[model samples]
Target chain A: MTENSDTLGATEKEIMYATHHAMVKSGYAELSISRISDELDKAKSTIYHYYDSKDALLLDFLRFSIDRFESTVNTTIGAHPKGDLDHIILTLLPCQLKKEKRQLHCVLVNIMPHALDQEAFREQFTEIDNRLKTIIEKTVRRGVRTNVFRDVDPAQAAEHILAVIKGAMCTRLTTNREAATARARTSLFSYIDSHLMA
Target chain B: MTENSDTLGATEKEIMYATHHAMVKSGYAELSISRISDELDKAKSTIYHYYDSKDALLLDFLRFSIDRFESTVNTTIGAHPKGDLDHIILTLLPCQLKKEKRQLHCVLVNIMPHALDQEAFREQFTEIDNRLKTIIEKTVRRGVRTNVFRDVDPAQAAEHILAVIKGAMCTRLTTNREAATARARTSLFSYIDSHLMA
Candidate 1:
């Protein structure tokens, strides 16, 4: 699959956009090609021509969403390692995404339960997670090189960071517990300060 | 609404058992009153006699599961503060659950997305989360009083600890990535050692 939306053909892009709107409106369980087609203002046959099933369409939507996040990272990431790390944290946490993209995060949250039983969906999620972890790992490595971070296992640090982000996202989105996420964010930064900072 | 399973009548307990099996077998999306009846080897009308809707039944099922967890914690929590904290941590984490209870956790994970749009479901989840957080907060407070732990904000510490547990649960369950959970567990214990240890 293409790494970013830059390489997607116009029709594929249209399909992805339709899928996003449909998922945000109807959620993943209720999402169907008919709903996506209605959003596309196109026929179901058109979606079938491109994707054999709704799962195929959703897999592409997952890629589309991740590519959008990659673009966000490209724009938001700074040369400063701490800034880069903080931006990444904010990006993953709920309520920080652009208003439009916030719905996309909800869609991802909706798809997570689906991944528990769907192997293809689970693999895509794993890939998305690994890519995010790698971004954090690289940032930690950069911080270590600059002497801003202590000598620590970058991979371990990345895992812990992403785990807390996932937790905060889940807690905030599912329970609407903003204070819990706030507390988690403080705890995470404190961990960085004590363990990762020099 | 009962705090534990002891208050549940025999029929209610039977319905809960049927629900556990049905949810584990079918997952939440496909769960139905009819399937639960099949598990009970009783008529669908019997289930409907007690609960008006599938959502109602599932809500009770959530309470049943939480009550089971409370029972486990009641038995497992030790007199020692550190042991109490560690037991709670292990209880919340994925792999450490009893074999039968693991499927129950999977059912909770499956039910999570349903909470996104359903108010009843969301309220139950929030209640469950609040209860767990309170347990952790109490544990931390006890630890601090006995000088086994530093004087940390018990609520903040509890939130952070639960967040990491949630992150580890999601990572392990969704991605099947044991190593990620392992790293998170280590990071979590390290956090406790540095921040909470007196």
Candidate 2:
């Protein structure tokens, strides 16, 4: 799917976009190609021609999201490469709490439980989670090595950080309570200030 | 549902048990009264005698779960009244990670997103969450007053604790990654020591 992005035309982009919104609304099992095509005013064959199946389309969608996340993380880290952990962490939280990301977060949250039943989805998610973990792990390790963070095990600390963020993100998406969302986000800063800061 | 436990007969208990398992397996929309009755080897009328519809059944199930959780929390806190945070927190984590609780946790995790679409479910969940938060809030306030914990906002700390536990629980329920579950569970203990310990 990523091999020929340049070759992906406007219609293909539109199909992917509509497919994403459809998945957000309906989830994987409930996803309807016809509904997406209806939304786009195109035939289902348009999406079928680009991606053979719903799973195939979603797989590419997940990859696209991961690629986007990786790039965003890199850019955020690049802007704060000198170990401003608060800014880096803040960058992660607010975007998710915003109204626009709620649907996407909801869809992904649904995928978590379904992963227990579906092998393909589980594999894709595991791969994505592992990649994300590695990114956080590298950042924590660099922080420790540079003495910006106190003595701490990088892997364990990374898991904690990931847990807070993922846990917070999932909670934010699941519970629409603005207070809980803000509390989760702020607690991350509280956690870093209390534990990791030098 | 909670009133007059003595008034609830064998059939009511049986229906509640069956409905709980059905919700765990199929979620809210897919739940069928006939299927639940079939599981109990009874007529659909038998369930309808107790519940007018599926929503009514599920709502009672939610209340039943909350009541059970509240009693369980009280019993646990009573046992650890002096701020034995490890025991109190440990009580929260292991049960969900166990094989028996996975399906129940899955049902709850799924409810989180369904609430995003259904306002009634959202209200029900928010009420349940608020009650649960209050329990933690009171416990933390007592802990602080007794000097068992450092100075921290009880509400904020409760939110953090809830996030870590809920986040950890959702992650544990969704993924069969023994490593991820183990890491998330391990991270919770690490969180309490770093944040709540005086």
Candidate 3:
């Protein structure tokens, strides 16, 4: 068994990758592990050995998603000078540049309520939400201090921005990507310009 | 069977009502029909008779929700003058005054994606989305023609407004209602006023 496990090659990796993608796209609630096993032409026990349960697999997928999002946003925002709220927001909010980010947005909007209802997942979700909120709040506060943004409440503004970004991404998930991108960018910039202090 | 159904009476109605509330709060994907039946102290068959499948049951709940929201918005907006966009927007957006509207907002934000995946439910969801968008577009066009709004693309602006309203409602669903209401109203009015002709 150890030798077989050692020889488990690219096919096993492909199977797990496919399972994760399917789960993210359709949701874990609707996903069937047996179907995933069948798709991979792997034994159920082998799949079970890789993931203790569907919930465990979902958690892994979510962790990967959260990390990727945090890193992407960090890289995009960090590329610009600090306190450039418009640049930071423009980079993060639009769904055109990154497919993974859009998928993450869909999962976030669709899976969050169910995730919140689960006792084990509640704290993890709360932490992630707060972390994202904190990043936006900090940027808004910086903009206010620099007179780039009006004297709006940073926390409230951050929440609103996040909501709009999420909503725009949700719209894109079901509509034409190019059109959604254009509309989202225009609307977001118009909003920022209108809201910012002269 | 008809006599037995008649005998079931208000009890079944009460059970369905409770289940509907629970489904809205938790979402149809996560709702437990068995638990709902247990709570009602009724056989699952009784519930099944009224709702042939979970999809049917959820669709019924959604239909009830759509009717309630449409009526509430129509009545609230009708009470004001004919071309008052701000009044119409304020009345239509989910807030504390209309608890049912808030619940419907939750259902839309949480369940619409799952409904989109179901063939039977997709048309209904699309109809509701298109109907709401058309109404807003018509109002924006009226506002522009009356010289109340600036020379903007009415369809794009209408979609943006819908995005913001829906975004705000999604925020309200996940956070404190009072704060969410205050922020949504402020942002909404600000957006509308900024676009109006001076």
Candidate No. with top lDDT: 1
Candidate 2 C-alpha lDDT tens digits along A7-118 = 4578877876787767656654467778788767888887888888876776666656666566666565543323445555665677444544655666676556556666
Superposed model 2: Cα runs more than 4 Å off: A1-14, A21-31, A39-41, A49-56, A79-84, B1-13, B21-31, B49-53, B78-84
Candidate 1 CAPRI grade: medium
Q: Give the lDDT ranking, best first.
A: 1, 2, 3
Q: Rate the local accuracy (lDDT) of all candidates.
A: 0.79, 0.67, 0.60
Off by over 4 Å in 3: A1-64, A77-102, A119-128, A147-153, A174-181, B1-52, B60-64, B76-103, B175-181
Task: Indicate the docking level reached by candidate 3.
Answer: acceptable
Residue by residue across A53-99, what tens digits does model 1's lDDT show? 87777778888888777667656557788888887776666435465
Cα lDDT for residue B51, candidate 1 = 92
lDDT of 2 by residue, B1-198 (tens): 224233558897788778777766676446789879866789999888888977777666666676666666656655343444555456667744554466666667656656666666666677666766787888878788877777779899888777766756655555545566567667767776667767
Q: Which candidate model has the greater DockQ, 2 or 3? A: 2
Pairs clashing in candidate 2?
none
Q: Is candidate 1 or candidate 3 better by TM-score?
A: 1
Model 2 residue B189 lDDT? 72
lDDT of 3 at B132: 61
